[model samples]
Target: MSYHAIVIGSSAGGLHALKTIITGLDASFNIPVMIVQHMSPQSDNFMSRYLNQLSHLQIKEADEKEPIRQKHVYIAPPNFHLLIEEDKTLSLTVDEKVNYARPSIDVLFESAAYAYGKNLIGIVLTGANSDGSAGLKKIQEAGGLAIIQQPQTAEVSIMPQSAFDACPQAIVLSLEEIASFLNRLNNDTQSVAQPTST
Candidate 1:
């Protein structure tokens, strides 16, 4: 299938996991990626800048009412919940925290599922809490693909394990395998989008 977007959620060891995945995508990768990595409300834009420097794709904090564009990575800013509007633009809200996180992974994933339906891919990475499980399940219910980092390979296994339990059909892979699989998806999508000569 030609996935249009990816929504990723993480907590504890999220920075390292995000870095690994973003670095794996080559410059030609076209899928839009949205990420929610739990951070303190006092955090700044440093993480987005750091990840952008490490990735070929442009990485930036998701802005209010900004359109979601392909080949870019958007991260939820601190102290707000990043949501996908029905029109596919972004909406940021200072809604009360869910699962003890302001930028809740569940919030992002659920909204993306509603917006993209089967064209979405939801991935749950290393985390300490169970915040992403229900969201991943929602993605699966919407016929979207679900991927979870292998609990054994995670820095902290609870989050991935919880996702696996919630969505047994999720593809469980190690960090390296996840990267390779995403690259393969990019290649497959490229092949599908190319016009075939008669």
Candidate 2:
């Protein structure tokens, strides 16, 4: 099945995990990816900038009202919660923190599940806390795909383990395996999008 978007949530040992997965994406990968990486409220755009330098996709801090576009990676800004609107546009809020994070993984994943439903893919990467488990479960309930980093391979296993506990059906993969799975999905989607020659 063709997926429209991907929502990723992470904390703690997230940077390395994000880099591994994003770098594995093919240059032709054409899907919007939204990420909520737990950070200090004073954090800057350095993470996005750093990832952009190493990725084929354009990675940036998401802007208010920005339309979600393919081949671009949008990261939630510090001290703000990023949400996906039903119209497929982005909105940002300084709402009270959930899971003690302004850019809570639950906020993004729930809104994305509502907006994209079965067309969404939600991923929970390595983290120290159980922040994303509920959100990933919501994604699964909405018929979206749910994936979690294998607890054994996670630098901090609490988050992935919590997610797996919440949604036992979610696929659990190592960092490398997760990357390969995304690449395969990208390839499949790309093949479907290409025009068939007579």
Please list the C-alpha lDDT of all candidates, in the order they appear.
Answer: 0.94, 0.94
User: Model 1 Cα displacement at 23 (Å)?
Assistant: 0.4
Indicate the worst ten consecutive residues by lDDT in candidate 2: 187-196
**Per-residue lDDT of candidate 1, residues 1-198 (tens digit):** 988899999999999999998998878899999999999999999999999998889899999999999889999999999999879999999989999998999999999999999989999999999998999999999999999999999999999999999999899998888888998898888789886787
Model 1: clashing residue pairs? none
Alpha-carbon runs more than 4 Å astray in model 1: none
Candidate 2 error regions (>4 Å): none
The residue pairs in collision within model 2 are none
